[model samples]
Target: MDIITSHPRIVKMKKNDITLYISTFPLETEDDFLEKLKETFDVEEACDGKNMAECFAIIYGGIVISKNSIFKRIELEGYFKESDKGIEFEINRFLENPYNCYTFDNGTICFIKNKEKDSRFVDNVGLRFIIK
Candidate 1:
């Protein structure tokens, strides 16, 4: 995977003491992207708040974990996999799914995925933010 260092968010976030990074993993096809996405969700199924600080949000294919913030734990109650529609179906519609906001407090984790993964961006995986 190639590193996308020139993304605007990366530049802007840097000044704010937040780090952003994206991987250039080719998104060959939407199907492939969904599969990988499902895997990612599964791997991060729960944010038990083992060692959180303030609050965290999963935005646009990146994770923004903020320390000394105002959150304690994020409830994973309505995550895609928890939908009644089924994980596969929900995963397919994730791009436009409305239950996108997942917040946790005291040092939780968030995952970001963005439009950059579209063919317009050469189907490269979206930016993945990991702020300390």
Candidate 2:
């Protein structure tokens, strides 16, 4: 995040852009999940622990977590998945669902979609915010 000024939260974005997709593989407890999201992710989900953890979210995407330090952890604790390509494929598939909206911080806040398996730029470029 490139900082232009402090007050309004304006920052330069990236070129290729990166989207971090997060998820809990077989959650321990719904109660814990809700509290964790509320505390850590600042996200909330209705509870009851009635279904598998997958039901809580789809693709569980987020941002800025694989910055070398994070990827260093092992399976017992590390967040980054072992297979990135696999995860990318899965994310591409996940984005295909109509309910999902794929976006990027590529120099501008852009709402995008998967045009093909590996399409980078969208035709319309969708909605964007250019920092003047």
The segments of candidate 1 whose C-alpha lies over 4 angstroms from its true place after superposition are 1-16, 27-43, 46-132
Please write out the lDDT profile of model 2 over residues 30-121, one tens digit for every residue.
Answer: 24544444344433343335232222222131222223223211111122212122222223443443123323343222222333433232
Report lDDT (CA) for all predictions: 0.26, 0.27
Off by over 4 Å in 2: 1-16, 22-24, 30-33, 36-132
Q: How many backbone clashes does candidate 1 have?
A: 17
The top-ranked prediction according to lDDT is 2
What C-alpha lDDT, on a 0 to 100 scale, does residue 131 get in candidate 1? 30
Against the true structure, candidate 1 reaches a TM-score of 0.17
Clashing pairs in 2: 22-60
